[model samples]
Target: MEKKLTKDDLKEIENQLSCPSGSKGIEVAVSMNVKNISMTKASIDLLKIANNDVILEIGHGNCGHLEYLLNQAANIHYIGLEISKTMNQEAILNSNSLGTSMNTSFELYDGEKLPFENNSIDKIFTVNTIYFWKNPNVFLQEISRVLKKNGVCILTFAQKKFMQTLPFVNTKFKLYSTEDIILLVNNTPFSITDTIHKKENIKSKAGDDVDREYTITILKQ
Candidate 1:
């Protein structure tokens, strides 16, 4: 039998999908490990992380993927930027529990500004967080500013057609097609180097099977 979602459950899912800010949101994020696993794998694979690479992840909820990245390469420094205070702290705790605290750090921010020096980051990546970007240009500019010359940035998100099938992607969520994302990035200082598309079936919070199309766009700073 398919499990049903309550109104509060749906609300919490929406919060997790959008911003993931509070205690309830943190719980929802932890529960989403299954969905995040594949996306994280794809993003990491696209990242091509090297030894001693300075990497930053935007909107890293619960930091489960950070553990995966740390385990992939030794001495790779990672910084995570999240707008949610609870999630920021939860990610820090998650890293500590995984024994990755030595190389990982989390920061709470307003989602538009980045707190890194110019040309300081070697690589950056974000997954499933673009919908919550209040100002895409500002975030893109920040990414360009912090990334060293020829640094890589990988962005992973579900395409608009697939995202529209989800009930929680309401007005609060900003949906974008592949072209829209390309256009947005073209306006930034970075250049789109490659785009990878994949389709997968996943069960929704309401326990219904849904088909999702994931896009990973690699950019060079």
Candidate 2:
């Protein structure tokens, strides 16, 4: 047996930390991805968004984050992109279950190739999914093509800044840094808007109390 932080690591992590037993109910597996922030605090940042904004949520697992975002930006139009139909369908169901959504919807599409017109979206957000993007440059370019001028993208990860938090620990994980992501985004049409590093504790799928640090990066077109 080997220990590594690859796609298998994440998939196993997602499976372990999922709340509730079985695939029944809303199946909030992805919630563990952002458990460090406590879903409640994540909602606060989403509250700052303006009303009637056009939003695009990428790699939406079950729409828990989207539901929180919708609370503040009521008039916003939201579309979710997910590669897995099962996860995408679950996200749609979750969004609809949260009291008859009016402007929120879900789509089963690959995040690398989004179907959107140029300068159409006002804001974009992703949690715990950015690092998994196969072609980050193309993904960013597609995002740039769809973002309106002044539109912003906020990417928050539960463990992106793990390298900083565990400086003395050596782990077999491909820990991505804020600078790495910034460079990736900079290569696209968008530029960095803001970068903030913060500490947040999370409960892992294994029920381990893990303190994860994330660097929140805002990219603007």
Task: Report the lDDT of model 2 for residue 60.
Answer: 62
State TM-scores per candidate. 0.94, 0.77
Q: How accurate is candidate 1 locally (lDDT)?
A: 0.84
**What lDDT score belongs to each candidate, Candidate 1 first?**
0.84, 0.64
**Per-residue error at 148 for model 1, in Å?**
0.6
Q: Ten consecutive residues with minimal summed lDDT in candidate 1?
A: 1-10
TM-score of structure candidate 1: 0.94
Q: Per-residue CA lDDT of candidate 1, range 168-220, in tens?
A: 66767889999999889889998898999999998766567888898999999
User: TM-score winner among the candidates?
Assistant: 1
Clashes by residue pair, model 2: 16-205, 17-205
